[model samples]
Target chain A: MNVEFINPFLTSLLNVMSTMASMELEPGKPALKTDPIAKGDVSGLIGMVGPQTKGSLSITFERELILTTMQKMLGEEHEEIDDEVTDLVGEITNMVTGGAKNILSDKGYEFEMATPMVVTGKDHTISHKAKGKKIIMPFSSEFGTAFIEICFEH
Target chain B: MNVEFINPFLTSLLNVMSTMASMELEPGKPALKTDPIAKGDVSGLIGMVGPQTKGSLSITFERELILTTMQKMLGEEHEEIDDEVTDLVGEITNMVTGGAKNILSDKGYEFEMATPMVVTGKDHTISHKAKGKKIIMPFSSEFGTAFIEICFEH
Candidate 1:
């Protein structure tokens, strides 16, 4: 994976969490994802198609982090996953992907993004559309960990 | 839900299974999907973006059907979740969606399709991208059931 292609998404994820949910995320390391099972309880996934390249981006959130972030962003504490939680996660996924899409567009990688899908369940599965090594970037915060998986073929 | 928009997919699914894998599918009554938990062991999901409406289509197959279909299609059998199964499921997802896409395109609904994503696990979860009621069109075959989830915002 090229840093030029991937750095924008990492920066975008950090920025989205900070600005939207007031959650600061410290990125740990980038690794190749060998397993298809999700790392967290809930995930939002979006696919991207460009003139030359196409791929997918997904962000998985721990249960505690998702619930706690909901309290901060919506000012309401929710006990379980509902339309509200799914909506918030969907927005977060859209914002992160949209932010990176802009930078990539400016760099001449014009692309179109699909609507994001949100899934909530213990040990849920997510598989990217792109064919290649999918990279998992882990981030730590006060709540727990956020995993961003990116796959792009070049 | 408009039958005009969804009938193509149902017909295409039956045709795809019958022609591609020599499996005949009997579609059951269409109903709204209230549960996010997947109905089977493996699923393939694809998203669509169009001029007016956008949504997703997913095809899930039971383990026996997947294995049996693989045996018929590839002349191989005996497997847990593996690359071959996922690839075949992905191709089925693509073909079924593509078949309907062509019919829908002829009907004047131009759509750009995202590449399909394959997920395999016991009791997995699947969430569609579009808003509004998600419809599950179930089909029965010799092996087991195959569920087709369709959601499009109108």
Candidate 2:
């Protein structure tokens, strides 16, 4: 796992959250996660592949943060996990990944991204489609907490 | 969605079931699915990327069939959906997609496959990463029924 490949996601996550949701976030120390069980109640995951590398990007968001972020971004009040929450999560995943994709492309790691999927459940498991180090970047904000997972195989 | 690209998945699915799990599968009519909710209790999904094309492949299996298939393949009895069931489903997804990948690559559609993800839950939603028509091929046997979903973007 190259630190070069991971910085883009953390940077992009910060960019997306502050710019998109007007929430400033501080990134906690990134760590390797061996378990597939999700830490949040809702998640959005997408796959990435290029000629030189293949990987996956995902955001597992706690319910409170998701609801608050949704309120900030979409002006909707969501009480529970529903279609709108998942849909919004999917869009957030796309934007976050897209931001990273551009930064990576500028660095010569050109790849195409797949559609994002949103999974919602307590104790849900997300098996990433990439075989490599599963690194998680946990972020904290005034709203709540969220995690960004990136699996890069170079 | 061209039937040309879809046949490989169905063919690979039947072949994988027969050769890998010793279950004979009869593929039903392939149809378009707009809904994201999965029909079965568990599912495995993978994404595909190439210079010219991008898509995703997935398999959703009934609990009964998964347990039975595990019994036949691993000679272990599993009455519940746990780590073993999800792990086996991930392997099946890999083999099925690998078979399809070879067929597609031989036809000059060279691409790379991402690792497969196993998702377990009743009515869980699987978001395909590719933006295109989603075609689902249903297969039935004495064991039970499973679905192969292929989303191809050209």
User: For every model in order, what is the number of clashing pairs?
Assistant: 0, 2
Tens digit of lDDT per residue, candidate 1, span B44-98? Answer: 8777777687777889888998899898877898678677788888788889888
Tens digits of per-residue lDDT for model 2 on A1-154?
Answer: 6888889889998999889888888899888877765567888877787778878877988889999988998899999988788888888888998998899889988888876767776656666646688888789876667988888777
After aligning candidate 2 to the native by TM-score, how far in Å is the CA of B83 from where it should be?
A: 3.8
Query: What DockQ does candidate 2 have relative to the true complex?
Result: 0.52
For A52-131, candidate 1 gives per-residue lDDT tens digits of 77777889998889999899888989988777888888889889989998998898887777777776667656777567
lDDT of 2: 0.81
**Which one is best on lDDT?**
1
Which runs in model 2 stand beyond 4 Å of their true positions?
A79-82, A142-144
DockQ of every candidate: 0.51, 0.52
Write the residue-wise lDDT of candidate 2 on B35-106 in tens digits. Answer: 765577788877777778877777999889999999988999998988788889988998988898899889
